[model samples]
Target chain A: MVDGSARISQDPEPRKNNRVHPVLKLLYKKRWAYYFIAPATILFCIFTVIPVIRSFILAFQEFRLMGNVWVGLENFKYVLTDPVFHRAMRNTAFYTVVMVPQGVLKALILASILRNLPEAVQTFFRGAYYLPGVASAVVISMVWKWIYDPNFGLFNFILGTFGFGPYPWLTSPKTSLTSIMLMGILTAPGYYIILYLAAMKKIPRELYEVADIDGATPFAKWWNVTLPLLKPTTLYITITSIIGSFQIFTSAYVMTQGGPGYSTMTVVYLIYNTAFRDFEFGLASAQAIVLAAIIVFISVYNFRVFSTDVQY
Target chain B: MRRACWVLVLVLLIGSLAVSFGSIGAASKWTGTIQVWDFPRPAAAEEWELQAFKEFEELHPGVKIEYTKLTWAGGNEKLDVSVAAGQPPDICGSGLRLPYILQGALEPIDDFLTAEDLKDFHEETLNAVKLNGKYWAWPWYNTLYVMYLNADLFNERGVPLPENGEWTWDEFLSAMQKLTFDRDGDGKIDVYGFGFTFQPTYLQPFGFIYAEGGRVLDIDKNEFILDSPEAVVGIQRLCDMVWKHKCALPGAGGLTTTDVNNAFLNTRSIAAFVDTTGIISSFEAHNEKVEKGEIEGEKINLVTAQYPRGKNGQPIAAGPGVGSWAVFKQKDDAKREVVMELAKFITRGEGQKEVVPLIGVFPSCKSAGNVWAGNKNLEHIVPAVEYAVYPPMHPNWNKIDEKIMRELQLAVLNEKTIDAALKEAKRQIERLLEY
Candidate 1:
């Protein structure tokens, strides 16, 4: 073996070059990776990026059935002065303020409970909770419309059993937004719960065992070891929930129709009505851009609020 | 061998193409699909439409008809979006509102209709479909507001019905008050005196406004004058019915016309309500149920009455509702003609006569009206047609209607003062008109 190695080492080595283009070299190295991601990248460009750019352009154009004309800032001026747009923004803000935190907290608590259960029971509860998450929002909204009917509603019926008089749920302006928010908090937390549980399961088991050996209570172990470790997951769920709550439209559309004096109006609902109902696509596009800005601002604010430097 | 095979394949391709083209060229028949959309009609009328389409297909062997029935609730929005996308139906049954015509999506029927066909239609009905001095749609049927009285409830309460289908506003108010009472000695009222929806499309209140000689949009001035004194009084009376007198249901702001109709026919919880003549069939069915002892209430002698005369002593009625077949701009002249023919056939032929009794809508064609003339069920329909006010024809009335209805609802709910609501609505409408 020594003699063969000595002979192989005596042979001349191949030359290496440093003259290849960096981009071409990179392409050669990661060709398989690029090939795998190409389809998804092309789809995103076509469906998401291109439409977004077009919507921005459309915000400054007066769109007609025959043609579109450039009318810079006119649509923005209309949106700024429109009272309905203001009301829509306020309603969306109210919904985000109430629903996002409630959803996150409920999801976190349920996920904490789910993590401690036996594996078999945990699977059952997770499936049960996630069932509603799989349902279409429109179908859920239609069911909720019946549940909010003043004459015969499940909520009023339950309240009536306790000797309270019937209360108008979706019919009254006073309760319409709250009713929609309540539906959101109750039905949608399941998605976050699954996410949180998956994150919780990833925590090192040794940390919990060490906390137990140090005479830590279950709650103390969760607080001291689990929560800080789950910071990234919390931040993600919080950001997504806030963005989702800001875009709330289906319930307002299917159940209330932004009615009872526009109490349940959401920004997206207004955009839809402006574009399709009023045939003001330019103003609708401006409204959509404003909504996107709001979602971006809120998402950044959430990251600043909840993001923490914690590592295992 | 390979060269021979290539030549053989080329020959076969050319031969097949020639055969297909030759067959198509040999036929002299017109061939294409005509798309037709209509606002939702009753099952009977829908059957009539299907039968008529079959007949049309048979008359023209190569022509095909694709029909889509749309609900009134969100049909207009769907139609608007489709038209905006430049894929409008070749023909559709719509109200022929000014906004649709102003969009230049409709084809004027001016050149298509012969003088005889034009003469066959009611002149006023024909005028209803006109904009910019051109006929944009073929009038099919028309519906106007009529007061539907639950006669059994009135009789049980000893409330005198409107004499000769006429009443003054004071008498109407008095009747509404007399008709309201609590049963079972409970403080809670089970039966409301009047059934009126706050829904915008259910423009029963427009009749009242018209009765007052008040107009909403000043078409000449191109401004909304909803805050005018007469209009204010008209809206105030409607609000008073819901809030001050509590004659309407507590949930009036949320109830749709369908809900009001249900309360009248099935629940028998309302004494009287104003609606279009389309409710006659539903009312008749309720009476049949009562006669058969299927329901607990006594048989109702459903009667139609005129809207109460206003301070002007005029019983003017208006509906923002009309039924007409509109022709869209089709690129091909032949297809356009085919669509117009289909529209004419539906509006003037057997289809027109078949839908009147089923839906209780008055036909726009005088000859079609003759089919149900002297029919006891439609006795009030023809009389009510005389009072039908053509809704304001401004291009922006759709948005104006929504704003007025929303603010009017706010006033009715006591969330804002009626004056404030009207002023705000007028401001909103002004902004829209400016746009």
Candidate 2:
């Protein structure tokens, strides 16, 4: 890193503006770069940053068509006591807890297997695995809804062929959350696989060869060399999967509508229902802020745990 | 130069002549667009809407109408966002409840109509859209829930049907239990006596509650009385039908209105179901299929009956599914006038005749009823108009409805006791009322 900085310092063309103020000279030198990024920065601020800030403000106010009024802690009080909110939080936690580790482990295994395959075969399988991720969540939910239909779904039909009776895959409360979790585990691991595969490729072949020279088995080499080196990638995948699972909404909404008695209700789905369906924007914003805080806390904790000795 | 100027004048004159000749009756004095957000209807069902738009646009040449069709699935959410962002459409054709909930955001249309013109609408239909003795919207048609019975199943089981299209809840329960049986003696019940989803429409339990003289809100006192004895009785009956009797098909807790409708209409697995008058179209199509030898079973003889009477002995009163065209409070008076003009045009004689039939709803206009007189389906719902109950009007009624429905679902699913569910619902509704 120091040698790279020294090489850039030796570039004579960039050092010619020594008379101007240092900050001004630096700004001038990067003017075209700033200009190139201005559109994206402006768009991000307008769409994302503004709404996020506004939501934080809204969390402390009451929304009305005529005007908004400040109502600090009131919305949070209501949300905290809300029975549906409690159910949503519990359901969301269950989904995240069950889905994240399952997704990360599945992706890691698949990526490890793909790493040993021929380049062409790896590419083919990578595309195949990533294909479903390209489909919109709504579309995927709709297709899964059909597959989970109690009477005439593909799952029930296959079950019937084995002399077992039809099963209500999504309709029954006992199975609804499990069915949705299965979908989350399936849909979430594809992108993680690609990331893990890229990270695996970056690991030096010398490490594995050193293990091989030490008379290690293939599994031992993978465990002692490849797995240890993939720590940063694994941490990234786990944190992201946890966040994604916590926001499970589309499947529950499109398929069950948080129904069979709110068995599949997640925090994000509850937020949508409270905000849009019930027209309680302040309460919704408070719920979202609480959710964001919970996510941040969990993610930070995960970073401390999984990222303790991450090399690279 | 004089010759060239004369040639240009000749060209201009020809162009003027062409414009005047081509746009004979297409002259429109009004200019600007009227944005509309409407609940999604089948594209084929909007033939009259399309025709009216064409006629309106032709007569008002410079005027443009930008129509947005919103699906019922997420339509209320879309409207909530639009209204929150202060960009609601110039006109909306949603239910009576939503526009009323929007309060000052809607323009009262009483000023746009004369007493003589207003008298053309059914009083019950008008009452649904009126708040503070002023009309917020002009009605297009009325939708009411009525029981559709399978006469074949009733006769086959030798179970007597409701007399005079009316029966008490006791009689209704007795009939349903008798109608349910194990065919082929296989010990599995092949036929369900009734089918209905527990979705929170003001169709079933609310209808039953109203029949018993109980209500969700006392408009005068502004209090939620959902846990009243009469309301509890109505909800208990519904819950018992699922949890205790099991007369309905199992897993009805998850069925949509369409799912139940299909089970009753096409599959014949369900003996009866209560739904909107629009199910007449499905019944007619089924009858057509039977005539064409496409279906081999004994023909389904569909009969429309009144919803069962509650303890007070009055027939169930369904909330009027009044499809109303509400005008938003626009800044421009000219735009408001155009919106009112278009609304009046649609609710009146010729326009009403064209639209009401496609909608499969009973006409709101007294004169428009004549256009559907010969139709049997329209005749069935005509009696329901008198029995149509207006839902409690409040700006927070939608939220109240959601809470009530969610709790009712929990009760029906055995997630909560009937008393617990209704109590929680009442608490939530009271809190909303306080707001």
DockQ of each: 0.23, 0.19
lDDT of 2 at A26: 88
Candidate 1 chain A least-lDDT 10 residues: A10-19
Residues B1-435 of candidate 1: C-alpha lDDT, one tens digit per residue: 999999999999999999989777645445789988888878888888888899988877789999998888888877877887888888887746565687788899998889887888766577677665788898887777788887888888898887767788889888888787787574556678887756655578677777777677766567787788888887888889877887876666665566677677766778888887766776678678888889777666787788888876655666655688888888887778778888888887456778766766777776765555666544644655645776666566667777888787778777789899988888778766753
- Indicate which candidate wins on DockQ: 1
RMSD of every candidate to native, in Å, equals 11.6, 9.8
TM-score (all chains, Cα) for each model: 0.78, 0.78
Where is the poorest 10-residue window by lDDT in model 1 chain B?
B377-386
Candidate 1 residue-wise lDDT at B317: 61
- Place model 2 in a CAPRI quality band: incorrect
- Best lDDT among the predictions, by candidate number: 1
Interface root mean square deviation per prediction: 3.3, 3.6
Q: Clashes per prediction?
A: 0, 2
lDDT tens per residue, model 1, A1-312: 569668756757733544577799999899999999999999999999999999999999987765688999999998888888999999999888888788888889999988889999989988999898789889998888767767556887788778786787776888888888778766747778889999998898999899989999988998999889989998888888888888888888877778788888889999998887677788899999988998998788778776647453
Fnat, 2 decimals, each candidate: 0.41, 0.27
| Residue B15 shift from truth in candidate 2, angstroms | 44
